[model samples]
Target: MKKIFGIVVVSLFFLSSQVNAQHKIRIACIGNSITYGATLPNPEKDSYPGQLQNMLGDGYEVMNFGVSGKTVIRNGDNSYVSTKKYEEALQSNPDIVTIKLGTNDSRLPYRLKLDSNFIDDYKALIHSFQQLPSKPKVILLLPVSSFLKDSERQTDEVIVNQVIPKIRQVAYEEKLEMIDLHSITADKESLFPDKLHPSVLGETILAKRIYESVVSKKKMDFDIFSKIKEEKKNSSFYGYDCVDFIFKGRNCKVVKPRFSASGLPWVWRARFFGIEPQADIALLDRGFHLVYCDVAELFGNQEAIDCWNAFYEKMHGAGLSKKVCLEGFSRGGIYVYRWAVTNPKKVACIYADAPVLDLKSWPGGKGKSKGSQEVWEIFKKDFGLSSEEAAMDFKGNPIDLVPQIVKAGFPMLHVVGDADDVVPVDENTKIFEERVKALGGNIMVIHKQDVKHHPHSLKNPQPIVDFILHSVKF
Candidate 1:
């Protein structure tokens, strides 16, 4: 009788995963624990994926195929039958497949030994998804945060630390769309009453995360002034539970496949979102800041003005905020060089990737100037410094600013490639790293021995993210 009942239940769950025949956007929930939400009062209404399907509106069908204790390599049954489930998902011909697995595999921050072991398997799964006749888009959910020790608190520590890293490595390798669902989950209070399965509310938050990643499109910066009108919060960066720190300046921000830590809540900042944290840990966890201005030094261009104003207004209204982290890629690094010199006291750290710091070494303007006409125009217009005196303002030059950097001092993550064509990896990062290191400063360099150009991000992204996180306090 139990076997018959189990078969009937599996049949219903399987049927629920299939689309409603007319076909809108078909999504698949392929994981465990949170996907099933057996701990919720009502599994149908409470499972994260189930709630996701509901919140996603009338145009979507989501199939939840999460088997608790299932890992990517093997679900402890030591069989590749889980691949069959994916095959079934492919047969359904869904437009997208969202994977939230790996929490079971890592369970703690450092259980995995070799990168290839777990990463290769994850790559295999991606390849398997690609093998689908429909060729659905694959979006990986960066694993959520776990307890500090993972002892009596959670069972998914391995996914949070070890497996998720490998998965990210694979995402970069495969070029799949990814979201920061894990970070959102981590920042959120407990979703489980027993410290494991998600409550019904937790399901809603997770589902909304997947929906926003696949469906929504938002500009980099959203409205900040309006939110301040809506929520009566205190402090410059709101320090409440379940707030996304990175969204402090921007209003409608969306992190389409999030990058890493704290990237989750950020993913849904532009769209309607939710964060269901556990009751006990709600107040204990210090939430993420509302706004963070990365590379405010690059605030010279018309491109940088709007973002600066938004951040400035928020900081002004809130009184004072944390030191901003300065991040710049390619020529934008030159802006970092300038911002750092003028306001070193306000900056927390520097992240320079292929920055063009010197006009003499590698002249500026992104392929705009036929000669130096555009250059002189920028010097006169953008700097607002008299052309005659601009030359003497040698202090703002990134190359010249090394002395100030040494004196003011901040940690830096320098990533450059030996064969970069766009920014002449040699002139930009090589010399900058050398000069900065010569002074007393903390700098970490990821020099790709043979790789070329911007492609270096595909190699190691965590180091980039680590630099961003390290720039913050509390």
Candidate 2:
């Protein structure tokens, strides 16, 4: 019996050693509400520990070191909650330790003013992880928005003014990886539950921010499906929501944003970055925004035309004189060509990729079936004209608009794929580009191989942005 017991103990020890050898990587996540997911029940991974562990892959075992109601400064009353948990987790000799805290330390409730001493304490906390036995890569987790200071009920002004710049500065100086969770969580009310704590999506975004930042720093291809662009290095491509700072040129005008009966659809604008937002100030000052419109609202024909009309009216009122460069997908192409024929002087360029330009060209179009009869109804109501007259008025036919485009000498750039069965390239972009060139206009067409009508920003995300950036003329 004694001999059998000894053999069993040896077997158990060997098995444990084998398991440890199989999983060599260790990661730890430490922080307060956002990290522990306060409003949320703790899952095996509700914290960033689970998020990062899953991101690293099957080999990693990340420990959750986050604690709710924690602050960086303990105030000698022993109120600081995170330190104890962090110390315990470090015993495993982690390969990476992430510290996500300090917003609570900076906010008014705890009233913990962050002076030099506080910064020193943060430095020490960072140093402790740096000096760990494994000496893991340390990343500083920046905080997003604090609770809105009431009265605004909107967090746009709050985050843009107070939090983001400081966080950016910290990352720049410390040479630590900055996970810009604030970028996605800007409209805190949207991402948050009570407008104080984050929702499930927000927590997921927080995890995503850390995961991408760490992975991208290694300069490896980000394996995540949705690869959102993040601000990198000292090169400042701003996420500042101070929209007033964006000047619309001509008479040195600044658009003092006023909400119409429509409370300025700030949520939608923030959510959909249709294309890249980076722009040179000099180009904007010379009149670049006039040609672009957010076609997110358009799918139906009449609705699309109305949206274009509204955009044009606004540009005219703004005294925008510089020629505009136009780019959009599907129904947006319909609106752009329709307006360009009439207002030729205003159009600098146009590029419609996988465009829904002609009604008859589409499947189940109003020409064949009553598929778009609802759209036809709205068209009659809006322009008080018959179907044929309104289609001619809007010139839904880009081919018809060609004579006017030729006379105007507008430059255009297009990207489309032959594999796009929805909007066949030959019928749309191929024919249109040929017409523009025939009309003595310089048009650049990039035929994407085996792809569909995707935003140039969506595919390898830089060239189309560069084209737009350079396409503008003063």
Q: How many clashes show up per model?
A: 27, 0
Q: lDDT tens digits, residues 344-412, model 1? A: 666667766655666533344233222244554554455555664564354455676788776777777
- RMSD of every candidate to native, in Å, equals 17.9, 16.4
Per-candidate TM vs. native?
A: 0.45, 0.45
lDDT comparing candidate 1 with the true structure: 0.54
CA shift at 357, candidate 2, in angstroms? Answer: 19
lDDT by residue for model 2 over 207-321, one digit each (tens)? 7656644453132221111211222112222311112211222111121111111111111111123343322211221112223344433433455545555555555444343
Instruction: Please report, in order, the local distance difference test score of every candidate based on alpha carbons.
Output: 0.54, 0.53
